[model samples]
Target: MQKKQFKEVVVEVKHVSKHYKIFGREDTVKALNDIHLANDAELQPVRRGEFVMLRGPSGGGKTSLLNLLGTIDRATEGVIELFSSPITPESSDEYLAKLRLEKIGFVFQTFNLLATMSAYENVELPMIILGKLKPEQRKKRAIELLTLVGLQDRLDHLPSELSGGEQQRVTIARALANEPEILLLDEPTGDLDTKNTVEVMDLLLDLNLKLKTTCIMVTHNPDIECYADRILYLADGVFEKQAINIEQTRLDYDKYIEYLNAQTHGTH
Candidate 1:
């Protein structure tokens, strides 16, 4: 197999830490401790179009790390650079918000769709917030994205009317509304079943390959690691190890189907 070469370091983390003060208590809990991504020997700098996975136990700071990367939360200490621009604790809220809107896309585990909105409207919300696209353009793009996620017929369906997987797919479409350079997913398939999980993974892989979207996903399922370019294991708020996923390079829908069949047939 040929090794993949990536150009440009899209994300950089240096000596980062996150802490939260306990309510009515004198002690503070450290969510992350001196995590450095750019200088790590095992984990290379994140590049465009790379599918990276962060796997760890609950409360191990995987979600915390994802939040920081998405710029939804600020770190207690150290620097985070996105697109070579340093994000410091002192960065203004406006700056961070604009950065997130323009460069970053996020999909959460709960599928965070608006309860009252249809799938089309939910997907169009981001573009409306960005205030750059016209009404017609927003509608067109929302349809395109929903169609891309195989929900063309369900655009008028509300969150309550859709299944869990469909709602999650709508959330994914919403995340891509701004055509972000990096996509951050926090336990995207946590609520999905085995079949739904496979479908979502296939969609993510397609997006990564076709759109060249940089994907950083936090997951606890080791089975899903087969779709990652590199897997970083986190433990106790620190990176424990890293491995290049040779399987991801050759993975496809057919291969996954074959694996499923083999497992069903009790074959290794």
Candidate 2:
């Protein structure tokens, strides 16, 4: 693999930290401490194409770190830069909001789609809200995304009509509607059964390999973390471990899960 140039900064985090206020907001709990990140080693700098995983226990600050990186939430201290622009305390919220919409795609665990809307409608919702596409074009693009997620036949199906896996696929389709450079997903397959989990994992892996979309996902499932180019493990608000993909992340993820399960049950 050829080395990448350090000319551009896709995402940079410098000593970024978050502290959630406790009680009525007097005390604070540090969620992240002195976190620093950069794409200096990224070979294929799409200004957007990098897949990284964030893993930790519940409340270990994985979500907090993501929120800061995505600009949905601010850090209590330090700096964050997206596309090389410093996202400091002085950065305007409006600008950050626009950056998020224009450059980032988010996938949540709960499949945050309108219950009354069909899969197509849900997929088009972002474009409609952003007013980035015309009415007819939005419809066309929505269909395209549904087709990409293997939900072409379920375009008109409501959330209630789809199974858990199908609904999650719809959410993934909706996330890709904007053609975002950076994809932020929080526990995407959290509620899935083993089969559905595998299916969703495969879909994400396909997207990463085929599209090379930059993915930053937070997952508690060790089985899912293997699907990324790199995994960062957090403990007590600090990222303490790192793993890089040698072959395919899926194989590592499967083996890791099996190891974990065996350790849990003392079967190994």
> Best by lDDT, which number?
1
TM-score of 2: 0.87
The digit string of per-residue lDDT tens for model 2 on 179-242 reads: 8778899999998877788888889877876776778899988766666767888888887778
- The lDDT values for all models are 0.90, 0.80
Q: Each prediction's TM-score against the native? A: 0.91, 0.87
Residue 267 CA displacement from its true place in model 1, Å: 10
Q: Using TM-score as the measure, which candidate wins?
A: 1
Superposed by TM-score, candidate 2 places the C-alpha of residue 222 at a distance from the truth, in angstroms, of 1.2
Off by over 4 Å in 1: 1-3, 39-42, 247-268
lDDT of model number 1 = 0.90
